[model samples]
Target chain A: MTGVEGYMYPNEIRLYWSVLIVLYPYITGLVAGAFILASLERIFRVEAVKPTYRLALLTAMAFLLDAPLPLLFHLGHPERAWEMYFTPHKTSAMAMFGYVYLWYLMAVLTFEIWLDYRRDIVLRSQQTKGILRVIYKIMTLGSSNISERALNIDERVGWLVTLIGIPSAFLLHGYVGFIFGSLKSNPWWDSPLMPVVFIFSAMVSGIAAVMLFYMLLTKMRHKTIDMRCVDAIAMYMFYIFIIDFSLEMLDLVHRIYEANESFRSLNFLVHTKLYFSQIILQILIGTITPLVLLFITQVVKLPEIARKRMYTVSGILALIGIFAMRWNVVIGGQLFSKSFLGYTSYKIHLVTREGLLVALGLTMLPLIFLWILLKLLPPWEDEGAHAPAAGD
Target chain B: MNGFKDIEHLFRFAGLFVIAILVFLVVRGFIVPKSFGEYGHYRAAAIPQIAALPLHYAGHQACISCHSDIQAVKSKGMHAGVNCEACHGALEKHVLDPINVVPVKLNTAVLCVRCHAASAAKPKSFPQVNAAEHANGIACETCHNPHSPAIDAGGTK
Candidate 1:
């Protein structure tokens, strides 16, 4: 009664999808994005991006591990989620998510990362002592042969896995888009281009995140930053970001042009309820500003330090923008009622299961995963067994 | 298979994946609902299980059987079509033990506002009101009889 305006169905007064659902897409997008970046070196032969290959893989793996957590937290009967995998409804898009997530996590990402790191794992299995040695030995899965020929097979399989990973990464995030876009029930989410937009934005966000990580990690290690690698990453990020922005604009323009029945309500939502997240955080600060920063570094011959600064700022903004885009989609979509005559609000609780604290904890959980992953199977050449270079 | 000497690890991985898939399928066969996919993707028994749930709201016939006077009053007015349980909620317990299971007093101010509140989406023919402006949170029963809401009970309207 307090927040309700105009008219709303009794059920429409409370929004089911909260910030936890917001974190769902953001995490999946990061995982998809990171895997795509790793694939650039492995599949596309983008040698300049080689320095970040293993790091990207680890980042993807870490985030992928945490991706389903939000959904688990959001469910009323969290335990019954297994029922989805057990009795997957054929007609449901969300039902397919479990299979897709597992396939990507197991069949694609873990397989590729393991193959790439297998030689190292085998080496460490022999070189390390005690408990650590046992862990590495188990990780080897009883294939301890690090012979030159065995390593050759690992490389070949890893490359093939990378080849599969590119499309798997697309499906991973594109499906997240379809979850929304397929909802003809909500005009805000209904769009044919949603998946494509999600994929490109995934690429953009993933590339930028890895770039930031690569630079920061290198600095933390007191090592020289890979200018060429970051440069190539920035260039690709800029191009993909342009495409992502164009598609989003196309969606917006189409909505405005069609001016469909739900248009006025949605338009009002974007202007009023969604002004900060959509207009300020997503478009102006997140997208355009970073695009400008990247474009500047592209045309001008700035010093490495200046270039790094620009790249850093752009990466932070890109992540924020993509997150805002997700916020606008999940939260903003629910602000207006289906009756088309009223609006409601979402207030994220503090101490509840699907609360702000859990959301924050989930966001940070990947970084902790990355830390553990790094410590266990170090991605750095000096720290871990570096997989063989591109060709034999 | 003859010259696969150095690639034993590849064979091991392939074997491992095959075993995992088999294990998953075998386990799924046992855990998944037996009647699942009989008529559709979900368990066919779900329909009957849901149908078997105990009825909470006794039909109006059961209520009017005992209290025909109230039904006569309700039937004579615009509230004739509205069911007793619509306002009284589930009455199966009340029907069984009417004396001990008396329904609690409802806040008519709140209850009446649920349907009568001004909403643009409501059909124009419905006698909706801006309840806040109309009575300033006063109980609907203060001025109007709920059974025949069109008539003012207290002669205050």
Candidate 2:
């Protein structure tokens, strides 16, 4: 009663999609975008970004693993989710997600990672002892021969997978965009540009995330930061962020110029309820600030320390902006009634299954997984020197 | 020949992945309902399962059977076509087990105003009244019999 203003339909008072739905696309976009960054090194042969290649793949896998947990937790009957795979509705775009996810996970990310790491895994298996040795051995899947010819084949096959993975990554996140964009009744979400915007923003966020991880991890390991890699990544993030901003603005301008029946309600909702999230957080702080920071780094010659600081700040801002973009798209779309005559509010619970606490835990779960993944398979080249000999 | 031996394990791993997927598909084939894809995408059995649900609404016939007096008046009114359950809520329990279940008494003004409240969106021909101006805190049943709203106390009927 308090949040309700004017006349919402009896059913419209409660929003069906919650914050978990916002996390779903945001998480998937990271997976897609990170995979694309990894591919830039493997497929595009961008030598400068080679430092973050393994890190990017591992990051993508970490987030990819966490992507479905939100959707599963949100379902009233989570156990019945296998129905999407068992008896999929041919017409439903959502039903196709299971297959798409499987293809990306098994055929693209997992396969590509396995091929890339096959030689390292094999070498580690022979060069370790006790539980770690057995773990690496099992990971090798009984493949211990890391001959030059074998490694060559691995590189070739991995390259081919990365080539396939770029488009698969696009399909993965573009499909997420289509899910919201296809909803004709919601004028706020229904736009042909949604998938393209989602793809470009995903690239921005993914590149930013990998860049930050590369800088932070290098500093943590007492190694010098890879300035060339960060510079290249920051450049990509900047250009993609510009495109993403342009597309969103194009959508906004078109809506205002058209001034359709739903425009007044949408405009009012933006000015009032969405002012902080959309305008302040997403547009100004998250997007413009980060874009300007990255632009300054590109145009002006700065000290290495200054550039590192700039990239770090810009990367964090890019991530926040992309996340805010997802939040606005998912939450803002539901804040107003389909009738365009009323508005309702979202109240995020703390302890419930689909609550703020659960979302925070889910968000942190990926970083934890990434930490474990890094420990198990050290992506650094120097890891082999510290490993025990096969004879020992 | 030595180079090919190093790559042999890769083939085995690929085969295992393929076989695992095949096994899942085979299991899925068995678990999925037989009539699932017969009509469209949904399970066809769901149609009959839903149709077999217990009726919650007592049809007009059931209401008229017990309250013929009200039915006679309602038959002559503008609301004759509208089902009694639409305004009164489902009365199947009250009709079937009168001792335990009692029909809910609705607030008459609120019930009438739900449909008749003045709104620019409503069709111009449809009867619309500003409930606040018309009722002025008085119940609708004070002036009009809900069964025959047009017939007044002035002996016009």
Candidate 3:
């Protein structure tokens, strides 16, 4: 590796835009998306999606735990990151992260999860033994009674959290886009449409993840497939993907039309370093192909087997494609020098912590959390087991 | 009764064990070895540190004390406020053996980048230089006095 010694301009004046900035939003996008998927079943009362509702919640929680990890790692002094909350300045865009994260985690997701699982928690608290019992007891936090009134209250609270959560989800990912949009130094990122593109892409990613997870869980367990649930998810995903893909193209069109001074170099960089990701993976493979498949399947009202297969495949492809888009935007944008004089390559080390290895670890950590969450709360249990009969 | 309960617990244990090992290996690989005091000084050994020499501050006083005539000439000239040791770095070695020791070279553009690079906390207060344009053709000390270039040489405020 060649030394960057003296090659860099003065640290104060130069903007050290790095991939870590993009990773921060990428992780948050997963969190917001997963939670929104959970809300579809839990709040919207979509009985078809019941099997995956709890799983989606668990997935959201798992990724949410690590959402701030990339941000901490990227800071020059990670310890000082907490100061954004402790010594917040009103004008600073970064200071608002603490409040946003807290509102989602503490108020929205946590409350929703508790209301959804309160009956299960009360029942399990009685049967579970040893440390696991204690863990559940702590999780339930001294609330063990299960009643008709309590269940009604739980439903009421669930509705409130999910209702508040949609706008919260938009704000969470939208703000991240604002960070890039507001940055006036780089002409490539300076655009007002950035936040809208980010929110729609987040929704697409979220729905795609849920569809893939539900399919994978069924296949792994060798259970009878739930086609109705998959169909509903696919329909929602197809509509969102259409809008998301269009907004992304709109951003690209704006860039092309404006043709600013930085446009030539930015365009060249995209064609060179980001062509495969932006054009092929994101647009064609990730968005269009899956979109077309979903549309055809939904419109035709295809058989159960075909619909499940198509949704699963499309969902997986969409997830991979969206991640590739994030990679292109985050890593690609930084490859060119700010001077616009020359292009420097970023070589990611294979074994290093800040390299691809850490990223893979962060991605997989959520899967492990989801597994544990499933064991704790089997989402497939019939509602009759927890609630009273219809008439009596 | 079947042993489904024990088997489920076993699955959880196995899953956790596998994840723990994966995390350990990744963390171990990325952790940098401790060096350079508590701040764990950057392993930028390719570039030498300026902290070791006496040329930074005290050496400037010595030069001003002994070579008052040249100092006077410099005082009347453009380089007035800049301490003598600022560019010369630590000057003890040069002061001890003035004939043998080489004075620090203020010759290259790299010196400018060392302070001008984006990460720099207190970058020198100057208009941003065009690196591609100014980097190759000139030396930093050629146009401006190293000691107090802003104040002394031709005295432009």
Candidate 4:
């Protein structure tokens, strides 16, 4: 009531979905986008993008493993979540998440990562000695066949899995979009374009994440940054970013031009409550700045160092913008009352269950997972036992 | 059998997947409610489970059945439509064991104005009053008979 401006429904005072829900789609976007970037090399025969294939896969794997944490933390009884799988209501969009997540994680992602790494796992199981050897052996699933014919089968199957993975990645994030889009009760989330926008935005975030990680990790290792690889990646990232921006603008313009009954409430929310996150962080700094910077690298002939610096800054900006976009969608949707008369406020607690601390921890947890993953299964071609095959 | 050795591990992988699915199927059979998908999408037993809950507030009919004297005065007053539990709170336990479970005496001073507190949102026809100007720090029941709000108890108004 203190935050309320006009007549508000009593139940509208406290926002239900916290910043944790915001992190859910954001993490899932990174997962989807990274997987799609991996696919660009695997399926499209984009040789210049080949340097990032394994890194993208590992990045996707790391994030994919931790994607459900926010939801798990947010649920009242986190233990009862298996019921989403055990007794699913087929009609509920949210219910299908368990299966979609499992399909992507287990069926698509794990299987693909395993297939690609099986040759290494089998070799390491025999080559290594000690605890890590056990991990490799168990990972090999009792397979010692890393022969030419055996690896050929693995490659062939891995290609097929990558083929399936492209759509599964789309389904993985597009479904996240559909969850919000299908919520007809809320005006902010209800959009036919939500899934497509989510997929493309996911692509932008995923590619940018891999790019940044690639640059950072390379710098740390004192390895030369592969200009050809990053250039191709930047080109794709730029084009996809354009599409993502256009769709978002289309949604914004459509809402502004139509100026429906809910527009006044949403407009007020954008100008007031969501002024910084939506307008400043998401649109101006997050989106436009990066797009302009990336555009410069595309047209203008700049030094490699200058281009690299721009790309790094742009990647960081794009990620921040996408995160702000998710925050605006999740938090902003709940800020305004459904009555279209009043507004509410959301202040995320620092130490509570669904607080900023937990959200920040969850965001960082994947990078730790990636670190462990990179150590266990080094995505670098030079480090890996198996070379990137000339996929037939 | 001879060539199976070349792809023995792949077969083992598929076998493991099959076993996992079987395990899930077995577990699903144990946990999933039998009544689920019986009546549309929800568990049908939920209705019965909910119906079996202990009642907290006895219906107004139960109150009037015994306390007909108060009901007689209340029926003719401005508060006729208001139920006893609306002001007094839930009394199912009191109704069941009236001797041991005595209902707490409500402070009518604060309780009365919950609905009567003047707000622009309330319907114009409904009775409302500004607490400061109307009472000047006095209890509402001291001036007005709560059972019959129009009848002044103290003749102060």
User: Considering every candidate listed, which one attains the maximal lDDT?
Assistant: 4
Best candidate according to TM-score:
2
- For candidate 1 chain A, the 10 contiguous residues with the lowest summed lDDT are A383-392
lDDT tens readout by residue for model 2, A334-375: 889877999999889999999999999999999998999898
User: Rank by TM-score, descending?
Assistant: 2, 4, 1, 3
Between prediction 3 and prediction 4, the one with superior lDDT is: 4
Per-residue alpha-carbon lDDT of candidate 3 for residues A136-207, written as tens digits (9 for 90 to 100)? 787665655565665665677678878898888888888888888788886767788888877778888887
Candidates, ranked, lDDT: 4, 1, 2, 3
Candidate 1 lDDT over A138-174, as tens digits, reads: 8888977777887787898898888888888889999
- Per-prediction DockQ: 0.56, 0.51, 0.05, 0.50
Q: What are the lDDT scores of the predictions, listed in order? A: 0.89, 0.87, 0.70, 0.90
Residue lDDT tens for model 1, B99-135: 9999898888998888887777778999999887898
**DockQ of candidate 2 compared with the true complex:** 0.51
Off by over 4 Å in 4: A1-6, A386-392, B1-8, B33-54, B69-82, B97-107, B118-129, B133-157
| Superior candidate under lDDT, 1 versus 2 | 1
Clashing residue pairs for model 2 = none
Where does candidate 2 stray beyond 4 Å?
Answer: A384-392, B1-6, B46-53, B61-76, B93-107, B117-133, B151-157
Question: TM-score of candidate 4 restricted to chain B?
Answer: 0.72
State TM-scores per candidate.
0.90, 0.91, 0.74, 0.91
Error of 2 at A47 (Å): 0.3
